[model samples]
Target chain A: MPSRISMRFVIDSSVMQAAGRAHPVDKRPKRCRGFLDVVYGCNHRVVVTDEIETEWRQHSSRVAVMWQRRMRTHRKIWRPPPDAIEPLTDAIAGVESNRREQKLMQEDLFLLEAALAADKIVTSLDKEVHGLFRNAAKEIPKLRRVIWVDLDEPDEDGAKWVSGGVSLDPERMLGSSHE
Target chain B: MASRSGRGNHDSKQQDAGVTRITVAGFKSIREEQSIDVAPLTILAGANSSGKSSMMQPLLLLKQTLEASYDPAPLLLDGPNVRFTKAGQFLSRSQKGEPGGEFRIAVQLGTNDRVEICLGKTPKAGFGVRRLTSTMFGNTYELTPEMDHDAVRGQLPLAAKLADGSFPEEVREQCVWRVRQDRCFLGVEATHGDGDHWATFSYLPAEALSHELRNLIHLPALRGNRGRDYPVTAVGESFLGGFDAYVASVIAQWQTEEAGGDLTCMNGDLELLGLTWKAVTRRVSDAHMEIQVARLPRSTVGGEDDLVNVADVGIGVSQVLPVLVALQVARPGQLVYIEQPEIHLHPRAQVALAKVFSRAAKRGVRVVVETHSSLLLLAVQALVAEGKLSPDLVKLHWFTRSETDGTTRIDTADLDEAGAFGEWPEDFGDVEWTAENAYLNAAEKALRRGMKDAK
Candidate 1:
């Protein structure tokens, strides 16, 4: 039998921002190479809608500020893949028909729609808009939900560390309240 | 009005305002009334889906109406389906509570004497009935709902009688040809009367109508490298003939430049033809199938034959050839609708394609191309600046979507003689790179410096 394929992670804006700040040498958020590793390691596809691109563009000035700060650190910022835009756009359109009640803006709806179409996980740290994706996942049969949350806490050795939720064992979450 | 000089050429004759103005309404994105003055050349500029295609509908409708028989389905497909109940219900209703769907095209034609052909809803029939009416020298005739069964029989005697009595017989005959939308009816009209009397209206032949319709070619945006053998159909024979000639010339030019000898043979092999050519060919054998290409000559010394397959050559060349072939094969006086002609082409090739359009336009072809390349637009402006095309002949419209209005507006620009214009849109080219990312980079650098000082 073929192994079951399931999307395993969702990376949000916070994770992207954290990844940008985490570079010890550079202050600029480079392309999320580490995050990309996580995506590849889990055998999952990442999706972005035109709306998400637009939102990121709106904060481009800030991104530039972060980028300049990191120039001396010789750090690189994450850049979206240009050629993959058309396929991503098509994916967004495919989901538009399925999500009728979600009065999401054309771009927002498209992102959710794209996630549904590609059967991929979404990574965004937006608590407010998590419901939109969750609703889409419920309505769309192939879609699954993933969320990114702050996992910075002290371990048994009294050392504070940051980790991904997908990486944390469920048994660990059950015993620890700090997470 | 006859010209004083008897020496008249085809170009000069055509320059005599065959089509004057076109008016469109309730068609696709054009919900409000809009009119375009048909000059020697008219450029339509708009962002994607901003009713630029709607402007072409009047011309398409005219072609359909004049031909003896035509299926309106293809033309209708270009527009939103008003009859689709689900979609229709979703659309906002007009003041009258009707389905708010409507479309009409009115055209003015002739020189020294003018005639107007209007097709759409009349006040009596609402918007469902398609009416064709003609007005000349202040007289009007209702030529639709086709008066009686005889009109449907296609005799058009009522049309002839109306034309002869109200207007000059010649004017009436011209009006008749202008109104008929299919070829067979025009043929019937030609045979029914004394052939000489109908000769003035002879310009409205089936062949001419077909040619005009075929000119409205829409090239798809998708790009592919492998050459698919498109058949030499009647619709594209003239264009194919032109393509063959163009390719032959390119091969000849390459041979002269490379071989330093007179060109005598026409062969498919680019190497023998002396052109910098790359191709992929597939061969079948018992062991396995193979694909390959001949290596490009290095300097003057030729030794080992370099071989590669079609896939080895860059996609840009193969993808671009199809478009060039399609354009070359297109008949003159037709509208070629190309979406982003600059895709996968180098800057040099993009400019070359722009020149091709200039040449095609000079040959009496009308081209409507959509492009995001400033270089292509600049090339067109150069043609206008050099007087190859009149300033009035070139029209540029810009499409801008306003968030406040929730609508797209197409604004026309005036390019001065030097091909320079005022105020390009802030977001014209890669706005994200120039405005947002540039600022982000600066901030990032500043933050990094602060961190260094703290360390």
Candidate 2:
């Protein structure tokens, strides 16, 4: 039998904060830690980026501290990759389309770029980034075949982060002809 | 066969001059006349079946034939234990070579001195030397009136026998003084004057004239990993063949005072594997000997200080023992060919093994190897760049399969003085750079998302 291929997630800092469950100090890292536990149990890896690493280095947030501790113990957290130059440029244009002539932000550009590179879900709670990525599947040829999994919408059980804002089927996202 | 008219006078390449160049045509794998200019240390490398062995096979074949048979008159294409088969085995069938080609070999000894032999096949018999052509280089000299007629008459009969394909008897004591003829045999008994730096221009058989040096000691990758008792013969050459043949006994006899004695050579190599040893070899009987190994005092293992059979310690020790012994025992100025000396060794020791060969070469022992380790290559290059060894002394041939023909093409990856290669390994660099770049991009994306959500 073929070995199970684990899915990789380009985990953002906001999700890490929710996973940290650090607010009242007496409670469990309440929000996204549950989602992480679910993904962790299902053999999903969280790809942490340099930006995420720097933030953790600067603040030593509870979630970041826990990840730092686990870094030595497991191969779960990894650095993220970017979408190719041509594909990334087209994805950016798609994100900035139908908007006022405002420049794309570096931080926002990284999320969309990394999602395409890792070919994984950009597990994010940001709705704007979700719209940007879900639309990128409409522009870039390589990314057109990959769906951006949105983690903002929780499942009815409130325990799992369900796919939101984009179709889960990759076949539906493919066939986007980029000029 | 080409005819040689010995109207010229020059110097014949001496034994001390070393083999300058060896050219082969219709030999195994080599389709045409390929001349390899020998160096102080020449290395032959190519992948398995890529003709690397074919190049070396010629030398080994000649060497083995000299020892395996009494008939030096015949260049036996196939011996009982030799590599190649009949002459047809070496006959080139490639596009560049003739379909049923004859085997021709030439060894360029000196400027104008060379011995070329051509071997052809008949209907019933296999391939053997059909003709011998040689020009022994000697200086200009006019025959004086005082020359001995009696000694000169003796060589004419030998030349007449050579004309009828008869062998020349060994010249017992001194080099022979000979008077030149239009065509004659070049033999040990066929030299001019007292033979003081002077060679006779005669058409002697290839074996009788050149006497190709058999100073080579080839030990095919050893397999004596069992560490069992091996029988040692008290006579002949001390070198053993096979993977691990008599290596234990060799170690017992060979351990030197330099590395603190008692398998010190073996232990020195083991140290590269993060292992130090207390080695002991005992003779069970007149014919039997066994070797045992243990962790040395103040050395590290997993905490048990017990002696165990070398076989039980691990295969790395077993696989490496012969290599260790060969490196230590090989004499100076001898050519040694080792296949996969880094076999079963860790990266640190593999890198260190490259040093062993480089150091061996520096000591005037020509070491040739076929390696599969990139780390070993990197280490050798680093040694060259640091001026530890000259770049000219090192040669790297990367064997790759050709798309045009299925045959292997050897591409020389030249190493500069700074140890930089002309061509980088494909899997070693670009793939790694791409992966690292991808990871960094993803990491940055994750951090950016966290920052936005916090704001």
Candidate 3:
């Protein structure tokens, strides 16, 4: 069947690297690749900022490059320029009082900027940063609507979410935690 | 059998005769020897001026030389396939301002048969063959010009075999080499062992090599534009070198023969491409005809006009018709090199062209495509993953030029079962991403400025 809906997504470089490291029996890499394949096959676009592309260049495998080529050919790789992350970085740092959590958000700030630039959806393999951003969403208005998904874990049901065309379920948004 | 000119042995299993690899050196951007392994579906891709055409031009040069009306002075510098009036025009130039010292071309047919030739400037005669080496019938031979250039000296290991009595004694003196006027021989008599008797046996391999080179079909990038009138040609006569000249005639021939088999197939492919029109040819006279397109009968509704001259419709249909005809009429074991088959096509139609190429390759025609369309490449990969085509049949060569030396190098990649290239060249097909980022940046700035005005 064709895709139900086309959504723009910002996938973390770690997930891309995992997808490139495919295995015959390992479900982790399979799910990683499967999520991406579903995302591509369903016509969803991938958002890549300069930071994300840099990470991809550093870590992604040949398979990921091939997938990226397909995405580019289909016009499904949505790359927004590097936004002024300083504003968002200051906002997150102000909201999250803990230094470690502030550092976590700093490292993954590009995801928020990229997602906010387009559809506000993200797929990542980083669990701690995913949780810290969700918790900080209460104080940060811009990060509230960001949808954080981890394909490596079952809590977010990454397989089911991606298989379902990545619909923006209210429960998956960071703002849902505050509500 | 398909009546299309240059098509022979329609069976896919007969693809054993397809050209396997081509090597070009000291020609244009290719200063070093660059080899591309030709597959059933070979794709040559790179940025503009990265030497993609240089790889294929060698074959075209050979084809035009063989097809010329008169004997060429070794190599035909100007011809229908590729045009160059002088040797220095095409010879690779160095940054230091000197021309390449040597120019060589080698083509491998099948697994074992190979032909490699070197060209040199012949004083007043543009360029001529300096040395010829061929491996045919499981034996290798080298031929070079004698001192005065009146005769060619051949080193045939088969001669040694003949002397050792491994073969029949009748073959000993049967080796003969003669130059015929009607045939485009290299214009030199070849002799082995300082004797005339050992000459005749060498001509078979050389003739077979020439036949293969002559059989190469090149459809240049620029095809004929849409026209109301197309000329009719003699029945079953082929337009081998003139790709556009053959479209109308081939369509006319197919419409009259084999129950319109090729015509029906072409219409089906056009429909699949969302073209909505069927190509129809009408003979206006014995020597002239017009090719037109009519809306598919099923697609017409509400008393709409069904027929229109091909020139009246969108140029995309006209531009793609020749490509469709070329692929449909080509037979297995035949090499059809098309440049930019996706030109003037929508992204969807360009993707559909991949299916056309895949089908042609599966049927045994060696399809060599030079394109800058990533959509076409993606479509071919999708076909492999869908099981419509095997990965083994596809070969991709990415041409990249050195920043410092300006010489071209090829990076070859293979497709796996999942349709992913085994090795993806760096920064290839990334233009879309760059454009996307640029557009997004502009959009974001516009949004921020609009917000400032609202405040």
Candidate 4:
């Protein structure tokens, strides 16, 4: 048997905009596609919620179109449960009064709901998502975790990797401590 | 004639930009992003499960996927090269997350030339060149790290201009590649871009990159020497997992097409194996090919050696034969990844194998060795100390596991001018140390008891 463990991940829209550029002509500093490439190459499951897709459409539609050309429904994206939304908002509110955080809007909550139902990770560069993870970590022991990554930073800088919430070192996510 | 000249011109343009660094992340035991410097000879030294193969596997995966022509070229997990089924089987647990997570790999070809590739899950999973930066006009990053990009834009073009002046007018004026939004949808740009932002240079497609990866001979550690008559196959994939089919194909190729010197080298290796003066020759049947070893009498003065079946020889000879043949035919700028080239060999032959690596490196081939034999390492050191292998041309990486996180930690072993090491890992083959100590202790106790009885 192989020594590696199967793992899960979720990517956000802000990072998707930084997918690879059209070299020579397209001059931009987006290395975010590297993160996705590594995950997929390693054969880990990736989940993308509809709300995240909607957010991606608002900004990184080009990358979304690129995915359309090559996307396959094996372990790439998760089918969010229809009822994941209400429970996620209730879980978040029960954990803390995050009803007014503007940076992470309703779609992000949907992303969180999608995460909880499937036990997927929420990878976001937004501080609001990190705040929600911190709150959920403190108040809701059974709540699923999020992984915060800063793709905008240079490779040599601090915490450019997927850092775990709920105090997971090397940055992993877990909903139940039992597992 | 024009096309051939164009190819030569293009190769000469990028010849200075050799691949320098490789980075692997979220793959197997190598969960953290790790970078390894490529030298003419790189030695990966580690105990079991220390992430040496994991680092090399990323390149092999890409090579195999490209060989199979996997769609989108980089995202497929299951293929002919490896039997990987799902993402979970290989992802580093320390680095992976729920979904939408990814593992990335990048190769820095030179100072300013690099290609980065990423792979994530399926059903929205796609893999290809994530980022590619190159100075097709032969630009290199000779600037200080703190130098501004404005300085790069200023200084790099001047260097490229000065160097590119000697290039043919066709290469100097023509646009060879273009970039669309897909980044890797690159081909010959039929239409000129609207602005000066156009790179107007060469493009190395995913297949080209994969070709670079395929220019390697990866010998897994679980190799064996014994074989019966095996079927022959095509040229490149002939040396698949085991030497059964691969060795026959290799021998057949040797008989029909190889230069005479290849067999001479193989004979020299056989001599080192103490199968003194025995030469390897093949017997072809209607159904199969037989590799036979001939025994030579001590009088090289004037006697012909008759051939016998390779199976008649010890397992060690059959094992080391292909290894020697492979090294003998290695071309310049090729990569050879050997798991344990010293397997099933006597210490002397194993040491001879070290000379093989030194010789291969001297031939301009890059050799990547992952071995458990201290003799091989000592032989390499001896070669270095004797000034046969240059110190700068050699590299060593010591893979050790973290006590707390249980992940791998690879440290570059520093080599100085005299082929001495700054630090060597403790546990490659230290079991011999323990066994020797046990023997000494028991011998001393037995001697003492005998003396007391005599008194």
Q: How large is the interface RMSD of candidate 3? A: 14.0
Show where candidate 4 strays beyond 4 Å: A1-179, B1-19, B69-81, B95-100, B110-112, B126-208, B224-226, B233-246, B256-259, B275-287, B295-305, B427-435, B445-455
- Docking level for model 3: incorrect
- What TM-score do all the candidates reach, one by one? 0.46, 0.51, 0.68, 0.55
The candidate scoring highest on DockQ is 3
DockQ of 1: 0.03
Q: Please, what are the lDDT tens digits per residue for candidate 3 over residues A1-179?
A: 22377788888988878765534334555566667667766677898777889988988865577678767545577666545333487777677458777887888888888888888888888888888888788888777888888776755567667777667777778888687
Residue-wise C-alpha lDDT for candidate 1, range A66-168, written one tens digit per residue: 3222221111122235553334233334444445433342344444444434433344434444444444444444334322222222122101111232333
Candidate 2 residue-wise lDDT, A30-92, digit = tens: 435555545544455665665556644654445444444333123455464443412355446
* lDDT, candidate 4, at B109: 56
Q: What is the lDDT for B94 in model 2?
A: 69
Q: Could you arrange the candidates by DockQ from highest to lowest?
A: 3, 1, 2, 4
Q: What interface RMSD do all candidates show, one decimal each?
A: 13.0, 13.9, 14.0, 30.5
Candidate closest to the true structure, highest TM-score: 3
Rank list by TM-score: 3, 4, 2, 1
**Candidate 1 lDDT by residue in tens digits, B49-93:** 665655664554444433323354213323211122132332223
- Of the candidates shown, which would achieve the greatest lDDT relative to the real structure? 3
